[model samples]
Target: MTDHNQAIRDDIAFMRSLAEAGRQAPLKGGSILMAAGLIYAACAFATWFAASYPVSPLFMPTLWFGGTGLFFVALFALRRRMGAKTETNRAAGLIWAGAGWALFVIVLSLMLMGYRANGWWIMAAICPIVLATYGAAWTVAGILTQAGWMRGVGFGAFAMALVCAWYGLEVRTLFLIYGVSLLGLVALPGYLAMRQAQRAAA
Candidate 1:
């Protein structure tokens, strides 16, 4: 076949594989519902954590969690699409996805603990690590998936955290709160929902 015809064939095969995969799954509608739950948890936690430290400057934490909410919202929506389509091509996506959450946890820990540093020092230390883990996961999701948005939100969170550090925000302990509000509430559950569907579809 010609290259263009071959490409079309490949797309058709991909879709057919998905249809076959979707036939043997547990839950379909719940992915989006679960995402909704996760988002709620994140918002509630963010509110709680932010209130506890009314006087502290957790500007980064605020932005981080806020960005987190958006990311999860997008992720959940994306999951709904994939799950509703045929089979969720989530097997590879799930593997890398776990690593992404792990890195987020680590970054938030450091950020909340008030370890803000100077110059390229922070990026040199943290950025690569975060990128390495999250990037791997996003790559598995493929360029066409929601990986780009997740990567973008993650980078935004990191940048905001760096700025917060520069201004000397009190990040200690608050990182836990931020993590709770952000990942636990958002990414973790969102990851779980999609992963659950992904694995089922796989």
Candidate 2:
């Protein structure tokens, strides 16, 4: 009976240690966001130029689809380089992944809607929607990690969404704003998160 009680205590202590370790470990997978931000920002700028100038209509679709392809390639590479994962990292990854899928589905639906309606203005809504999705993702991460800065990022995303919407009439300007926003909101934060994770691991 004494042995049995001691064994139970040992299990409890081990579980507690794991929980503590996870709590201390920094979040991972920031590289994915960083890559996504940079790639899409360039895509946005290119699209803006395409719209402004007398570029081929094929340019816009090619640029965005190609940018997405590059993002996925980077995604795979970053995932492999992330090394071992912790519970917190796994949770954070899941949150971001779901957000990504949600955005994909939304974009596809909007595309379909544009095709059916024979009007592309509906596509303009994608800008605010994307930012809103990011806001939700960042907010969830903040809640999970108990990080105040992450929540602030979430708020910033929401605000940016409004800004994008306000400038929605000027499609060219909107793309420029979106590219800048991605750099400030997504790329910078992603870099910071990567640095923090590295420091924590060290």
Candidate 3:
């Protein structure tokens, strides 16, 4: 009986230690946000330019896929360098990573199905779906960290998604909206979160 009680106590203490470490772990350092934001923004601008010019349609696919690949590489590098894979970090990473995978599958499936035949409406619909994923990621991060501002960012992203949907079919407008949304919803809040993490570490 004594040994059993002591084992239970040991387990409790180990769990508590993990919880504390999770609290101290900086789940996001803004690197992912900055990298992804810049990639998407560049893709948007490039797509807009392609539409305005006589560029081949191939440019769009190349730019989108190449930039996304670069972002993923950067994200992996940042995570390896940070080496803060606490439970909280893992949870947050899973949420965003899952969203990323879902987005990829949806986009790929759309492309494979020749959804582009529907004109810009299909692309416009994609923007809302992407934004909703962003909102979900931020909201989950906010809940995990108990950060009100993060939740606000999530909501703001959702609102922007709706606005983007409303302004449909204009290539330039859609790209511009998406670019700005990345900055406001992802990059800025990520910067703040990074700063908060730094302060907590200090």
Candidate 4:
């Protein structure tokens, strides 16, 4: 019985050590958020321009897909440059990655189901989905890091999502709001995280 108890205690200690190590790991440089924000903003602008001008429908798809491709390529390069991730970092990455994939699947499914029939509703739904993803990831990160500010950010994201849903704004206006949200929620938080890491290192 004593031996078993000792083993359990040892396991607990090991887990604690791992958690501590994770907490000490260097923060993400926020490149992903910055890149995503810029890409999203650019896409929004391009979409608006296409609608305002006599541009072909094909142009919008090309711009969006091309911009997405570029963003992924940049993300890959950034990850490679960052080298190996710690356990906590990997956990965080998985959360955001899963959210992104879910968003893609949701959007694709909606498009496939004839979005033209309910274009306005579809557009409004997209914003909440995005904001929810951001909120979930940020909230989880905040819990892990014990960062009060991050929790506030996560709540703020959810609030924004609610506003988007309630207003059911037009696509062009929604895109503009989304761009601003990305800057505030993703880019700004990422910048702060990087700065915090730098200060810790210094």
Model 2, runs deviating above 4 Å: 1-22
lDDT of 1 by residue, 1-202 (tens): 5999999999999865654553444323335434533554455455446646654555645655675778577666766575343334455445545675786787666664535553323422343354344334434333323334444544544453454344333333333334343453235534654676667666
Give the best candidate by lDDT: 2
Pick the winner on lDDT between candidates 2 and 3: 2
For candidate 3, the lDDT comes to 0.76
| Model 3 TM-score (2 dp) | 0.82
Residue-wise C-alpha lDDT for candidate 2, range 52-118, written one tens digit per residue: 6797767767887899999999999999999998766677788899999999999889989988999
Clashing pairs in 4: none
Q: Which parts of model 1 are misplaced by more than 4 Å?
A: 1-56, 84-88, 112-124, 138-202
Better of 2 and 3 by TM-score: 2
Stretches of model 4 off by over 4 angstroms after superposition = 1-19, 115-121
How displaced is residue 193 in candidate 2, in Å? 0.5
Per-residue error (Å), model 4, residue 61:
1.7
Error of 4 at 154 (Å): 1.2
Which tens-of-lDDT digit does each residue in 37-111 have in candidate 4?
Answer: 677767866665565568765785688679889988988887776656666677677777888799889867766
Model 2 Cα shift for residue 82 (angstroms): 0.8
Residue pairs clashing, model 2? none
lDDT digits (tens) for residues 1-202 of candidate 3: 9999999999888666645655566556567776787778778767766767887667777888899889888988977766556676777778888998999998887676655575534655677788888999998777766567778989998998898888767877887888788877877777777776777668
lDDT measured at residue 91 in model 1 versus the true structure, 0 to 100: 51
